[model samples]
Target: MLVLGIDTSCDDTSVSVYDAKENRVLSNIVSSQYSFHREFGGVVPEIAARKHAENIDLVFEEALEVAGVGVKDLNLISVTNRPGLLPALLVGLTFGKGLAYSLSVPFKAVHHIEAHIFSPFIGSEPEYPFIALVVSGGHTLIVLVEGFGSYSLLGKTLDDAVGEAYDKVAKLLGLGYPGGPVIDRLYREYDGKYLELPKPKVKGFNYSFSGIKTAVRRLVEKGYPAEQVAASFQETAVSYLIGKLKKALKETGVRRVAVSGGVSANSLLRERLKELDVDLYLPPLEYTSDNGAMVAYVGYRRFLIEGEDTLEVGALARCPIS
Candidate 1:
């Protein structure tokens, strides 16, 4: 089956063509609006939505062209319609619905987080009953994946998501927007002593990064070296995440683990996870962030199990996966 996937969940306008029959992605295209939101030090919802609206069509066309397919050849239309910026979600959802209606193909609405959970298995089948750590700008969650479309919410962030904390800390250090990459780079470059940061004492599997963010703010105010601050923050944050994951592994006794989302692209996190004594799955860098390939892949899986949705389905700004 040929599935066209569209995802405008946040600052990225991504589209992909997945060949389900062949179990492969034909074309996965993501047009990021980082330049537009950089000046603001973070994503502005209105700007993100506007950029999605302007870029979705062009991205769609490019995806099809790269995939060597036409609209008439598509058998399914999958789109991210929930748990994202409302305006951005609507742009992709509306366009997807219209295209589905025109082509008389099935329209599938996918949950953004659920797509992230299975992103690592885009071209392969995922093992059942695995633990998933999904970290992104808008969400940070640890979920138990029983099977396709079957998820158990193990834990999530009580305050800012990890990526949000990274951005906020970067802003405090006068670093540019989309803090993860720059901060990660700085963390790798710095050789001096690192600033000490506090790890949150949240019980269970839940996480809290607000305290650490504040710690970074105080250090910056004390005129600490920006590189050391960034390095320290990255180390502390990644360690905190690993600590929680280790606890989850002990509690659930699930040795198969998968990590996904934008924050999963962190080099430090990847290195830490690789050291764990368990089967680990991490998405390719291109699929680490918001993208249409994962959305399409999950949509294909859902369609096989639950069929399609009606036109009455609408976009949602907040929705739980389980």
Candidate 2:
């Protein structure tokens, strides 16, 4: 089947065409709003929504053109509908619904996070019942995936997510917006051993980045080299994540592990996961962050079993896959 996916959840406008028969993405396009939000040191929801309004059509056209298919040729339409800025979600969902209706084809609303969870499956072998660590700007979660749409929440952050902490700390150090990339770059430039930060002592498989964020704030006030501070913070955050992932593996004894989400693009996280003795599936750098290809893949999978969503399906601010 051929599916077109749309994602305007947050600051990125992404669209893709997936050909399930070939198990490949025909075209995946993502227009980042990072440059627009950089001055504000974070995403401005109003600005994000407006940008999506401007770029959605252009992105859709580009995706379809690159995929070498017209809208009439598509068998299904999928769009992210929940757990995002309401205005942003509305833009994509409305466009998707309109397109599906005009084409007289089945369309489905996909959960943004669920799309992240299944992202690694695009063009890769199917590995079911694996542990997934999905760390991103808005969320940090570890889930046990048994199959498509079947997820068990293993652990999640108690307060600020890992990516949120990264942005806040970058602001404290006068780093630009979308701090995860900046900090990851700095981690390679400086030696982090000089500035030691305590890892949070949270119990079980859950995560807690708030304490680490607070500690970074204090360290910034005390005066430390920005590069060292950035490096240290990145290391500590990755360590915390790796600790929980290890615990999850031991507890559940799942030999397969996959990491997804925006933060999953971190260089350190990938390098660290490589050392672990298990079957690892890490989406390519492009798919690690938000993208439409993953959404399309999940949509096609869901449509096979559940069929299309009713036009009444509304966007959700926050929803869990479980």
Number of the predicted model whose TM-score against the real structure is largest? 1
What digit string (tens of lDDT, one per residue) describes model 2 on residues 73-135? 998999999899999999999999999999999999999999998887788656788998999
Q: Write the per-residue lDDT of candidate 1 for residues 1-322, one digit (tens) a residue.
A: 9999999989999999999999999999999999999999999999999999999999999999999998899999999999999988999999999999999999999999999999999999988889999999999999999888788998999999999999999899999999999999998899988788999998799999999999988999899899999999999999999999899999999999999999999999999999999999999999999999999999999999999999889999999988
Every model's TM-score: 0.99, 0.98
lDDT of each: 0.94, 0.91
Which TM-score value belongs to model 1?
0.99
Model 2's alpha-carbon lDDT is 0.91
Listed per model in order, the count of residue pairs whose N, CA or C atoms clash below 3 Å is 0, 0
